[model samples]
Structure formats: structure tokens, C-alpha cells
Target: MKDYDDTTWFLGQWGRFQQTVFFLLCASVFPNGFGAFSLVYLTDIPSHSCLVPDVNLTQDWHKAIIPIKVVNGKQEWSSCSRYRLDVVRNLSALAYVPGRDVNLTDLELEACVDGWTYSRDVYQSTVVSEFDLVCSDQWKQPFTSTVYFLGVLVGSFFSGQLSDEFGRKPIFFGTMAVQTVFTFVAIFSPSWTVFCILLFISGLGQISNYISAFVLGTEILTGNVRVLFSSLGVCLAFAFGYMMLPLFAYFLRDWRSLLLALSLPGLLYLPLWWFIPESPRWLLSQGRVREAEAILREAARKNKLQAPQIIFDNYHVDADETEKQPKEHLSIFHLLKTRNIRNTTVILCMVWFTLSTGYFGLSLNTSRLHANPYISCFISAAVEVPAYISSWLALRYLPRRISVICILLLGGVSLYFIQLVPQSLSELSVALEMLGKYGLTTGTALMFVYTAELYPTVLRNTATGTCTTVSRVGSCIAPFLLQLSTYLKYLPYITLGTLAVASAFATLFLPESFGRPLPQTIQQMYRRESSLKCPFITRKKPSKAVVLSESKL
Candidate 1:
């Protein structure tokens, strides 16, 4: 019954930094995903910032120092004029100056001659209107926006096996480093199509790295602390990440600049090579005893405790002592053949799919709700802040099933409410719709934690990948489904709500896994999955590391 010090326990285990990794990882994607996505609309803000250096005047000194006198003939170096210089230094200050006295650059002076001045006009007057995605082909827009999630689907399948065979730490860093490169490339794409293609590449890295990060988290730490660091930590990283987009956009304007600003931080993780340790569980799985022993010894040293006389490297867990379970191999296909894990997978997948669609659908639909679209969108997202705390509390008391069911049901009902409400109330209607949006967001957090817990260790990441992939399928469909709502009225929300309900109900069959040992195989998941009411994880007093030939290991 030995445990490491609470402070140094998770602190030593590489997984403790999962939140750090997730926050960093999420930071890497947001500039492109949230930044680029939000920037398409906000990009014009910088063009506003790119105004003439000195054109801000409201008062009039005299009638004749007009823009024509400033940089009229200086079209070649128009931005270098005295007016431009003054404007750059004191834009707001010039507002008090006489209008006639204020000078403008060549283009500005030309627009000013007839008092037909249009401020902030470099991109195009029609630029904002281009959003009339009504007629314009969005072939690349939809793909670029979601290609990362799709890449997750693909990466999850292979990353799990890679993590299994190659080890978590390497794949984790490898994928992230590669992802960082693509993320940079994604930022520079000339068009949305290229951006999306690059993001697709980065997405592969994002999902696989995520699995490895979690592998690190689960390998180290024990007790409630382990649970907290692994689950709530990731949940918070996403919540905080969503919250920061507007802030990042506010400070950094150029979409490309913003993307680079966000991505360059990932380079910070490269130095993490020396700090984080390889997963002890993964090490044990590979029968790398000497390595696992070294890691365990370090864990003991960090916590100032002695390593157990003999570290049990075998898959056998003694229920009498540690309540550990016997290991079983669970293949991806075998997940479907098994009843409980299969059931959990289906329900989790549905829940994941519905939430991804609903969350993105609402994000896409904000403009449909108001006059000041960005303002409305900002407030709508603000409401999700409380859900993360509520979800954390809910996880503490309620089981994942109840939490998920309630959240998804809430989402379903909320979506229904969105269409049911009259559009006349305007802002209030958007807020109501956002209630469901927040629910879907919360449901998504629940799914990430709940799904990762269902399978045995070997298949966990693979299972997580499967869940991630299925959800991306839902995300891929959301743009079309959400846009279709304009023609069909309540169809998209209603369809997503129905799916949420089905996903919620699927939880009924899954054994609530809270406060149980993480299952490591399909057989363990089925016949005797319950830790609350189980027979024995081990029959003997956990013998020495069981030697396994290549056939066994």
C-alpha cells in the first residue's frame, strides 16, 4: 500500500504536464483554427489599423488645407507623406483637429476630393460582402476549417499502434514537431484550400501527439490526483483555449502573423525532452524492465520514497492488495465484436459526433442571429466558461454516464429550444441558442474523459482515435447540416439533438467506470469489467515479472 508523495507524484510522472502540453498544443492550433476562422471576418480590422498615418479629424480649422494638399500627387510613396506620419503617431489625437486641415495619402486624398471618403478601405468594400457565402463556392472554406479533425480520424488509427510499438514519448514529440512545421506552413498558404491541406497535415500530428500526451499522463501518478490531472486538466486546456481566441485576435491582427504567433510557442515543447519521462506503463508493456525500473526508481527519488522491493512488471494486478486487473489484449475490430466495449464505443462515438457537429454548427451560425455578428458571437462563447467548472464538479460526484446523459440531453433540449424561440427577441434568442451550444461543449469534455477510460490500456489510444475519427465525420457534416437549417428552419439543430439523445442513451449499457482500475483489454472489459463488483484481478500475491516470449509480450 505504498504511494508517492501527492505533490511530487504526478509532478514526476510525465503525464502531470499533460495540461501544459494540451495548453501548448491547443495554442498551436487556435491561431489557425480559431484565429484564421475568426480572422476571415476580423481581418478587415487590421486594414482599419492600416489607415493613413494622419487622417483622423472631426473639427475644421479652415476650409483649404484639404487632403489634396497632403499626398495628392505622391501616389508612389503615398504612405510616407507628412499626413501619414502624423496619422500613424496620433490617429486618435487628430480627431480633434479641423477636418479640412487633416491630410490624406494619395488614395485617401482621391477618395476625399468629393468627400466620398471610405475609411479602412484597402481589402475591398465588397470584401465583407464576400461572406455572402450564399453564391460563392465554399469548396475550400469548409475543408480548411475542418481538415484537422479529419486528420485526427486518420492519425488515431495509426498513432495508437505507433505509440504501442515505438513508445509514447518519441511519437508524442515526433508528431508535435511535425505538426508544428505543418502548422507554420498552414499559416502561409496563399488560399484557404492550401491552408486546409496544411492543417490536415498538422491534424495528423495533433491527434497522435494528443494520444501520446495522455499516455504519459496515465503512466504516472495514482489516486484521485491522477484522475484530476488527466481528465480535468485536458478539459480546462480546451476551455481556456476557446476563451483566448478573441484575446489573441485583439492583440495580433494579421491572420498569418497571428498563426505564427500561436505556433512558435510549440517550439517551447521541444526543450521538454529532458524533463518528461517515458510512460512506466508503456515501458512495462514492452517488457523493458530495466528502463521501467529506472523510471520507477526516479519516481521514488522525486517523492523521497523507496521503490517497491520488486516492481511488478507483469500485467497481473492483485485485487487483494492494489485492486489491479489481469491484462487482456483488445484489438480495434475486436471492440465491435465485444458487447460492453462495443456498446460504449458506439455511444461515445455518437456523443462525440453530435457534440462536434452541434458545437461547430452553432459557431458557424452566429451571424444568422444578430446585427453585430462578431459581438454576438463573442458573447455566445462567453457563456461556456461556467460549464467547465460545472463539468468538473459534476465529474466529482456523478458517474460519467449520468454526467454525459444529462449534458447531451441538455444539449438536445437546448437545440430544440433554439429553433422553438421566436427570432424577434434577437439577442436573447441568440443567448438561448448558445445555452445548447454550451451544453454540447460540456458534453464534448465529458466524452473525452469518458471514452479514454473505457478500454484496456493497449487499446485505449486506438479506441480514443476511433472515437475522434467518428466525431470528425460528424464535424465534416455539420457545415452542410447547419447551413441547410436556413432553408429547412429547425432541421440541423433537431437532427443534432436527436443524435445527442441517442448517444446519451447508449451510456445505459456501459458500466460506469468511475473509481475503477482502467481496463487494459477487451476480455477484461466484457466478462468482468466492474471494479465495484468484480471477482479478482489477480489470484496470487503478484509474483515476479512474468517472463513472456515475443509471442506473449
Candidate 2:
């Protein structure tokens, strides 16, 4: 029997049909680029000080109202504390010069009683400024990002099962609508609590649609076209969207307006429904052979070629034999049923967790860079372009395991070196950080492609979603990881770098999927010889049933 790829070979790769699906699917993910990281600007904390109420005071007294404290070595005005207003007023009446006549340190300090005043140099308004989520409430800011990732975590758990059960196209578009609508509604959120609720809902849609689109595209396209779409095409579209976020935020400068701008673009994607089609492979897996054939025929029509009268003549449907077996609902647990897949799942989970920790940790840290947040964010997003291009090259030419291991090591090493640079060469520090981001970005892109290929169609989305679900745990903690830098400079880098290097070493245990046909069933999953050669484990020969199944494929 011919495999799906062999059966579809007549359609040709890189034709008009493949290009259309590639671009449209890539376009579908464009909004996800900006939507994922809009929190950087939405909750941005700008230069600020305690708001002083109107009172009779000298110029020096007004300046004296804000207490100065040493940060990193340089004296800077305290953002949360201020001189007691009553003391400042009395000092002003005494004609006391803050530095000349009286020592400012003698004055008592108090928390901002009235409110806070933020400089509009960077952001005109943000959640941080509007809600005063600073000082005592400062923890809310990072918690907000954590809430969003929690939503992503929950969404990842169900997206694969839902897609596998219902179909990819509906879940893809349905979740896109969920993300768009909730984001639009969030712009009008009256309080942080309300905004967080909406953000959580939006997150549920965000990652679901992202994974759905990824699986949908991978299943629809074949061979190297699949490689390009997975590695460069979809990722670059997302990076472009991310790149555009800072530009929009730079002009808007208000959290609500930036969110509005981000949410509205998703509406443009609704038209894509007609242009992109469902995965024919997924359709066949569900026993909808005719529907799958219909989609392939439409693709052939778009490619301006005539599909054969009977498309699935020599193709075998795995579902056909199990039609009367009560239709078992496959889940993530199925990935653990066998040793080969169980090992793959365990290693993939580790790789994904570490990758997410490094990638999102660096991405969210962009706002804290010693430069304009907008430019820093743009640079961060822009760096992914080349990284993804490099990923495409690596995915095309190198073995999957080597590519992942090498890029992960690059990220780990670059991040580890950032602590060696002096403060005077801050530019070099930023450069090394970007290089770390570059390496991680490339690894991330490759992992997306690599993970999808590791599992058979029956468990592809579930396995991918499971891996990404685990990754969200890393993302969830990434905000708190950034906070560690304040207590011990470079602590986050050291931690993330160590994990990256460890994940690199772990990659050696998984089988390489390079230049091999995607496995269509659990029986056909690629197994590495080294796994069997482990010193502590007993090697077993393949069962007759497994060998017979492989022979049939």
C-alpha cells in the first residue's frame, strides 16, 4: 500500500496550491506573533515617582519631595517612597534649602499617599501606571503574565484532543475568533481583575489556534515544502507580526489602544477560512476518506492539475480495521503506551520545558534592556527572522538531533558569557543577549517542526500539544525568573543557560527523524539503536505483530 506522501506525489510540491496554503496559514499565525507578547507594553513600568499634592513649596522642596536611593550604583529618585509632605511643607516655610541649608536625609519618608506620577517619555499609559501596580502591588504585574500562560497551559491540554476529534479547520478558526473577540473586549476592561480574566480566556484561544494551524499546515503540505512551511514560513510570519507590535506600540503609547490595534487585525484573518482547507491526512485518519479526497482534488484544481479519478486507490486507512472496535478516543496517555514513544515523550517534554524557559525568559526581558523598550522589543522580534531562516537551512541539510543540540548549546554559551561583559560595554551585553535569543529562536522553530515529525498522525497533535503544554509551565515561571535578576544579577541567565545545556545533552537520547518518512502508526515509530544498546537495559527483538505491521506499511 502507498503511504499518504506517495499517494499525493502527483500533486507536486511548491505548486500554487502549496504556496496558497503556506501563505494563508502563515498569515493566520501573524496575529499570534504580536498577541503573545503584547503584555510587554501593556504592563510597562516607566520612569515614575510619588505624586505630590498641590501645596505651597519652593522649587527645591518640590524636588526634595521624592527621596533619592542608590540603584545598581547610581543615585536615582525613589519611585515608591517620598519625603513626608507635611515635613516638606514646614521645611519650605522655614526657607530651608534642601541640600544647602538642611540635610534631605533627616526628613522622614512615607509611601505615596495620594498617587503616582509617571513620565510619558516612553509609555503614555500602561496597566502598571493606570492600576498603580507598583511597590506593594508590583507583584500583580508579573502575575498578570503568569495568568495568561496558565490559560495557555490549559488550552494546550485540550487543543490536540479537540482538533483530533472535531477537525483542525474548525478549531483553528474557532480559537482564532476566541482570541480576537476576547482581546477586543479586554481593551474596555475597567480594572486589572477584569483584564486578567479576559486575558486568560484569550490565552486559551491563542495557543490552541497556534498549535492547530501548525498541525494543519504540516499535515496539508508534504516533503521539503512541509519543512520550509514549518521552519521558516509560519515562524517568519509570526516574527513579522511580533516585529510590527513595537511599531504599533511606539505610535499608540497607550495600553488600551495598543490592544485594540492588535485585536482588530485578527478580523482580517476571517477571510482566510475560504482560502485554506482542512488537513486531508487528518480527514483520512478520522475515516473520512471521501472528504480527504475532495480536499486533495480541490488542491489539485488550485494547482491547475488534474487529480486522478481515484485518489486513494492504493492508500490504506488505518481506521478501516478499527471501525467496529468502539472507536477508542486516543489521548496523551497513548504516547506512553510503548517504550520508544515513552522515551521520546519524556525527552521532548524536557527539551520543550527548557526551551520555553530560555525563549520566553529572554523575550519578556526585552523591556528591561537599557534602551527604548520599543526598539528593544523590535530588535528582539526582528532577530527571529534570521534565526528562523537559519533553522530552515539546518532543518533542510543537517540531522534533526545535531541541529537542536548545536543551537541549544549556542544559546546556553552566549547567555553564560553575558555576565563577563562590563557595564561600560552594555552594548556588548545586549548583543550577547540577542545572540542567545537568536540561538534559542532557531532551536524553538526547529523543535516545532521536529516535534510534529516525531509522532505518527494518530498522536501528532496530542504529542505536540502535550510538549507545548509542558512548555507553558516554563513560560508561566519565566516572569518570576526575570525577577531573580534583581536579587542576584545574571542569576536568570545562569539558570536558563544550565537548562539549555542540559537539554542539549538530553537530545542525544532521542532518535533522529531526518530524511525519513513521517511514521504513520505507533508500530512504525523510529527507534534508535543506541536506546537498545544501553548498558543497564535488556534489548528485545521486535515482536512478530510489530514486524508484520511494519511490513504492511
In terms of lDDT, the poorest run of 10 residues in model 2 is 527-536
Candidate 1, residue 465: lDDT = 71
The C-alpha stretches of model 1 lying farther than 4 A from their native spots are 1-134, 191-193, 313-331, 368-381, 529-553
lDDT digits (tens) for residues 1-553 of candidate 2: 1299989998999899999988889988988998889999998788888999889999989977898899878999999999889988988999999998888888789998899999998888999998889999999999999999999999998988898778889999999999999999998889999989999999999989999999999999998899999999989999999999988998999898999999998899898888888888877777678998999998899889999999998876445333322234578877776556677899999999999988899999997675788888988998999999999999999999989999999999999999999989988999999999999999999999999888878778999999999999999999999989888899999998999999998888777788988866655564432234433356678676655543333
TM-score of each: 0.71, 0.94
List the candidate 2 regions with Cα displacement exceeding 4 Å: 317-326, 526-553
Best by TM-score: 2
**Model 2 TM-score?**
0.94
Worst 10 residues of 1 by lDDT: 542-551
